[model samples]
Target: MDMVSPHTKNTTELRDRKRTGEILMGHGYKRGAAKLIGVLVALVGFGLVHGRPVDATDKVRIALSVRNVVFLPFYYAKDRKIYHKHGLDVEIIQMRSDLQLAGVVSGEIDYTPAIGPATLGAANSMPVKAVAVLYNAPLFSLVTPASVSSLEDLEGKRVAVSRIGSDSHRFGSLMLENGGADSKKVTFIQTGSTTVSLASLQQGAVAAAVLSPPFTGIMAEKGFKVLGRSRSLVESPWLGLVTSKQKLERQPEEVKNMLLSMRDVITAIQRDKADVISYIEKNFKVSKANATESYDEIAGVIVDAMFMRDDQIKKYLEGTHARGETSKLLAPEDLFDFSLVRGLK
Candidate 1:
């Protein structure tokens, strides 16, 4: 009111604020501010900013039902450090097929390559899904002794399978049926594992066994006859990248990165067959020729992309119910989520 100009009033207020700051500094406010800044800097240095580690490599555990050439993409990714390239430290754990899906659901395993188990788990309301498929063909062979000339000869004889309700038994039955024999007539003995099943076939414990590579090649080399190869008759999504729904929903970026690494590994394997063959030979301890055979079988079936086609999904769904078994069948969209793989492309 007494001609107090706006500029003069603002300058007076600024000076008052500055004087207050100086007084507080004299009372140790400056040291407190400096300590706070130091703490923030330390947190940033330790990658604890915003409650997450920055640029940290994700440690992922992928469960393998059993080691076979169909699972070569995972092995190739680890050997070539492709997973590391995508900021992943992948540990390939070998576990029994029966336990893999349960492990995935229980959070003990992050992902599993056992596509059949993954699909079945989803149909039965397990908290899992098959995100991507790698091999879309059944890669098993019904191996028998020289005396058994045909699938019919397998009748009344004990055939070896890793387990009664295992993929080996299912696919082995399909192989027999495709060969014009009755799968029900043959007895499927649980041998605990494929390695043991192979041993059983070798030791004359079982007349025939379902074998995947390099075991298939191993048996062939020992003069065991391959009565039929499952791939020729059955074609469904075999090896796949499956994960719990929680992981897919909560940590999509991690899932995408893992799939990207796998997609790149598939490309590399397709581009350089020799590299994968060499890996098979060195890792599985098979002959170069046997490795090449295994590579040929696996290479032919490796999906060109991570996402499954409608027909492939249909084939997979149909294959799941091949034994005329029924369950609360989930829709394809509910059972599979390829959006992440689709987004990557």
Candidate 2:
């Protein structure tokens, strides 16, 4: 009638404890099969009773690059069980800065798709590897009031970017370069968030604001015109899912399955736009018209081959080289991985 008590550590770390327990028990330790069974029960009990972590691995712990059109693939993959189908636990983390090297270095997350910040991290040598492409475009746009017709109008006008060093800032800079405007012409204000930026645009705080997906779509529906969109460029020069090189070398099939899940989600985005739009609207507050625009924008960029356009990568690389960023970067070869989605044709 003797009962065993559970261990102190959480279920996610239980695997390690279980392994250690096995080692101890192998040498005739008292914390016997009963202890192992107790730990198993504890994991099941916490998950079943409290609805905590998902898989035996606890959670896939993926950092999603903000909630936007670019993330449609992940939204579908998580909703459609594609990540799960690939034997993953799959908890989608919503974050803007995907460059988070400290966490990735310390093993806090399993993976993340490329966002602009992560691309910067690669250019700076952050030990990240681009795994696959979610959408093959910039997935961002600069929104302006109806009064502003072109980038020239933006000159001497207040424009909003997320921050001075952020991707939105870079995007605004690119917009200026495209339009042949002087750098000092636009104010490049630092109001944050798509909603806040939209508000700033509406309130005359900023004549224009750079934002993404449903955000741009929402403001555009409300009479804000898209002054410039990153997708409008001839090529997409971005990265996603910048995984650690260690993961790429040790579990390449797992990486392949992850990319496969992402591609399958893209297929769904093209085929079943409406089914996913509800989430888009609920999360992004995007209007149906704007949702349509965002969805179309996403689908148009997903070529027959599921990978990013190679020419685009080459151009981006060349630009980085011109800036002398790649050589200065550590483990430059780990910056990208093209084996999975590249063969999807």
Candidate 3:
């Protein structure tokens, strides 16, 4: 047999070394991890090219649809970035109606700032729960020209509402019926006015319209009179925080933390109105006067009441339900999951 050359033996040794390194380092398997890395890099690049969506598990998403003066504190909370300060990655989206349940069930959002209607939704099997009570009571009213003089004058005259089934429309009807007005006698107009219901009356569209402040303040300054105010303390309603049952079960810690954050912000608002008014004006595009006045109004009427002084959650439901305002009675538990407010600071 021919003697093996030393150079050939060295070359074979090098080849063996290379094969051994490959196998140890997972060469065939490298493609699996490399491909994963490449896909991740491409995804990150895409997000950079466009906009990165929030990390679902890491972000706290909330949807708010019940809009108005009662809900203004949420705007203040959002505009001020209070949720973030509390170790939350919070997102606030504005929706035009009480569509909280769809988002809750589908996981499009983690919670809603308005929990009143969600109380109604819970009764209907939407699998949602309230995290906290924002306003201790309702903050809505029917405003009209001072010339109208009384709620009686509102009949036969056209009335304006944001939509057919909005809190304004439903509660306005209840207010009228409670005051003994025939619902059919008044003409209802849909104007989509969220915060400026008073403007509807100014524009000569209706004799009376539901309103929230700064619009309420503006109308009062402009010589309009208050017709009916939604008063939860004396048989009205409350707005609170709501989320899907799934969120409650999956991320109870996050939900609790967010509520604590919100309460801190709310307390801060009262604690520092001058600063909060500046912030509200900057973010909401309101007149400085409106911001200042509205902030003051909210302290007495909206915040710090725990859903009404008497806490008659049942009486409110009975009052509204009897007047055909809401379809049925709502359990108090249906309105709030106080564990967060009760447990967390």
Candidate 4:
């Protein structure tokens, strides 16, 4: 696979390569200072120091829970060599939410971008903290076949989620309750992924499924009824970077560099619209029109500076109440540390 060197690229001309078979942004206009002040006190680590490529010696591993559109930032970054530019030989791996957390906490995985599981894990007293907030709104839709006209109609029907304690479940439950439906009456099957959930829905194994774009678009095209979209049903932080407390304490430079690279991705998306839309089209295997639609729906939710407000953090933590009462008590400070992101240009 041809990889773009982080040191050079016309942002507009960047193209995504085939993922060796796996499926898998700009506003830019700012640069961090040159010279590392040591990880112990460096607030803003090396990211874009005059667009110079840092030594890519920081081998980092990031675990992705699913291949959803919300994770487009991570995918785009690797494709565009943003992490490499920041001195990170980042490896993106797919893992289940449950396992992703374990990997992060055990130092097996440096970071996992599934904010829902990470926040809930922190609430449950896990030693992991979110470093950034990517999407503040849930980009999911509670979809069912055309026979299901409303959220209430799904009572006693089966629903498909990625996993029992995963974000898909949380979003699905909230989508139902916020729509005045009894979530308890619905049976949620752990399909382990949106693609599987979609299969369950199509196979008649479930009556509804919580799916993100472009699955929602595909289902809608097939005449599925969208009872409610989570974006309108609830406001909560969806995806972002999360790492073990140990990583934060021991390798702050890696953390800060990762955050800065993410900031770079967000800024790139803000400035280059065509590249992202094209990426959506190829990455998601959707029509040009569908890709454009997904881009429009997802672009607005990307966070600025990868930081969420205090209130947004509270709301997001509250959304995990179903996990346990302890989840409701986790304050923003306990789950997030935006120092790295705050110091970026």
For each candidate, the alpha-carbon lDDT, in order, equals 0.72, 0.59, 0.59, 0.70
The list of candidate 4 runs beyond 4 A from truth reads: 1-58, 322-328
Q: Write the per-residue lDDT of candidate 1 for residues 26-109, one digit (tens) a residue.
A: 434331111232343344346432211113643577766545556778877887999999889877765556666655654445
lDDT of 2: 0.59
Q: How do the predictions measure up, each by TM-score?
A: 0.81, 0.75, 0.74, 0.80
Task: Name the lDDT value of residue 69 in candidate 2.
Answer: 55
In the range 202-308, model 2's lDDT, one tens digit per residue, is: 88887788887667776777877887877776465353566665566666666677777776776777778787776565555567777778777777777445555
Off by over 4 Å in 2: 1-55, 309-311, 321-334, 342-345
Instruction: Give the TM-score (vs. native) of candidate 2.
Output: 0.75
Cα lDDT over the full model 3: 0.59
Candidate 3 matches the true fold with a TM-score of 0.74
User: Model 1 RMSD to the real structure?
Assistant: 20.6
Which candidate should be chosen as best, given TM-score against the real structure?
A: 1
lDDT tens per residue, model 3, 18-70: 44335324422121111222343343345321111234435555655433434
C-alpha displacement of 306 in model 2, angstroms? Answer: 3.5
